[model samples]
Target: MSVAATLSPAADVRADFPGMVTGDGAPWHYLDTAATAQKPQAVIDAMTRALGVDYATVHRGVYGRSAQMTLGYEAARRRVAEFIGAKGEDEVIFVRGATEAINLVAASWGMAQIGEGDRIVLSMLEHHSNIVPWQMVAERTGAQIDVCPLTEDGRIDLGALEAMMTPRTRLVALAHVSNVLGSVLDARAAADIAHSVGAKLLLDGCQAAPRMALDMAALGCDFYALSGHKLYGPTGIGVLWAREEILGAMPPWQGGGAMIDRVTFEKTTYAPPPQRFEAGTPIITEAIALHAAIDYVAALGPDRLLAHEAGLARQLRDELRALNSVTLFGPEESAGIVSFAIEGVHPHDLGTILDEENVAIRAGHHCAQPLMDHLGVPATARASFGLYSDENDIAALLRGIERTQRIFG
Candidate 1:
């Protein structure tokens, strides 16, 4: 779909987010959700309870409270797996964030499967998290990397990606949505293209999981990654969902106390699948908070959130386009973000002025320096929306832009 065609009308849920208010009690127009979403009270309460009354290490605990905590932890894993439509909970591995999840795959699966002269296809709009890991793996594996171009509308050029795939292609990795451009990918089609060339596909769903409905089976991708913080949960927790067979086949990325079956001087046998990948002390409270975050979004409905944010993004783009000096990037119907630059003012200057007006936005390269270079600008000012955002926030942003222009003039 060109836009969020199935999105319903925006819901008024700002009160659910405690961070939506400024320190002085004014309504804080937070427009930088693409970096990290503000936590809901449900998530906060869940984490508080987990850390205070229910604290316990998982898996090895035998006491009643320990057992309860272990159950909660494992239940959280199941919830995460179900949320993303994983084949089973065993396929879900907890990592720090999507960045770590990508690295895990790169180090474990890529190192095991990718070899000399093997090709890996990547898009131009990939986040540094997605790009750097693959680059490191390719350097080690002696695999060659091919860069796919983007459409003029800022979407990844899948046609070019299909053309780029060859018999030697080992993997294809891309974002489910561009963090900077907010362009959504046709993940199912991308999966098909990769499979046609006997390659596995991995999607970074940091941006997509917040807005779209995800089904690992329907998407047909071998791997999917998401960050809890981006989904209105706590940081230090994210998920890597891979095919069960793939996880079983891949070697452990890290070694530590919990991820081992037996340890000895001669050898150590690793635990199965998910446990094998999660080494050392896991993020206990963060997982509980992530469960609450999933529940919060589920109650509101992902489809509704997608529509609501898309509406805000479309409106922002139209209004910004009306300004003669404003140059917009991304497709006409972005998921929940709008990136643009003023003709004369730098993005940092615009960001500063916007903050003075209580409208927070993201400025600079946004961790995608290659994309910035591709766009032929040092940086762009970005206003991203969340479930708490409303038309009032958009109006505040426009007013701030006008103020910035006057100040520059």
Candidate 2:
């Protein structure tokens, strides 16, 4: 079926998000969803309830509220597991965000499995979170890192990636969607390539999780990481989903409460998979809010959201490409993001001018400096979409860009 045929009309959804308006009550054009999505009222209300009337520490307390809170927290885990098509709830480990999730795997699984002369594969478009952790692990383990290049149109060159893989490759980590260019990866192909080399595959799904439906089993990836804020949930919460066997084999990366089975002075054992990784007091309220966020997106339907955002991206790219001074980046049909640069205007200046018109966008290296260097620019202005984005948002952005060009000219 054509994506457009299945899409829910974008106009009907904006009213659900309170953040879509400026303080003075103007329509706030939020084009930075790739950085972090705006929260819907449903998520806010869930969090408010979790923090206020229903507040209690999870797992430790035996009281009614505590038991209820523990149930709520664990329910959130199940929701996350189902959302990602994880094998079981036990495989879902909540961390601060995708950065910490990647670090956890690097510190625990990467440290245990990677050794001298081993190789790790990453791509030029990877977010710093995915790159730095692998680098740290490689440094400690004496493993070498191989960087996959991009295609002419900015997609991760998986053909090049397959050719680069060798028996020495221990792990292959890449982003499911490019944060800078919004180029989508063929994750299943990447997985097959990694497996062909007898290497594990890890996908940073921070961008993809919000806009597309994910199935970890179908993708055949060993690990998938996602951030809550990017998924329209609260900050300080994220998920790391791995196969149960892989989680069982990896040692604990951190030492703290809740993650332990029993604490003793001499030697300490740990709890089972997910809890062992959790370590400290969990993000209880955030987890509940994440559940709500998942429900919100699910009800709206991910396929519909994908189509809506893709349509907006196509329109924005087309309009921006027609401008004489604007140079665009990424694919013709990006997941939901468009990055571009004006000939004489720095992205920061463009961002500032756009803000003056109340059209917000992201402008900078976007934490992918390697990609910036590859594109031969310091930074680009990025306009990303969400369920709330529509034709009006794109119109405002174009108007702002026209103003920017006039100011520069």
Candidate 1 lDDT over residue span 248-359, tens digit each = 9999889898899999999999999889998998778899899999999988889888888988899788888898799999999899989999989999999998899999
Q: What residue pairs are clashing in model 1?
A: none
lDDT, candidate 1, at 80 = 94
Using alpha carbons, what is the TM-score of model 1? 0.97
RMSD of 2: 1.7
**Model 2: clashing residue pairs?**
none
lDDT of 2: 0.93
Q: Which digits, one per residue and each the tens of the lDDT, describe model 2 over residues 1-409?
A: 4343346455677888999999999999999999999999999999999999999999989899999999999999999999999878999999999999999999999999999999999999999999999999989989999999999999999899999999999999999999989899999999999999899999999999999998998999999999999999999999999999999999999899999998889989999998999888999999999999999999888888888888888888888888988899888979999999999999999999999999999999999999999999999999999888877788899999999888889
Worst lDDT 10-window in candidate 1: 1-10
**CA deviation > 4 Å runs, candidate 2:** 1-9
Candidate 1 displacement at residue 356 in angstroms: 0.7
Off by over 4 Å in 1: 1-11
CA lDDT of every candidate = 0.92, 0.93
Q: Per-candidate RMSD vs. true structure?
A: 2.2, 1.7
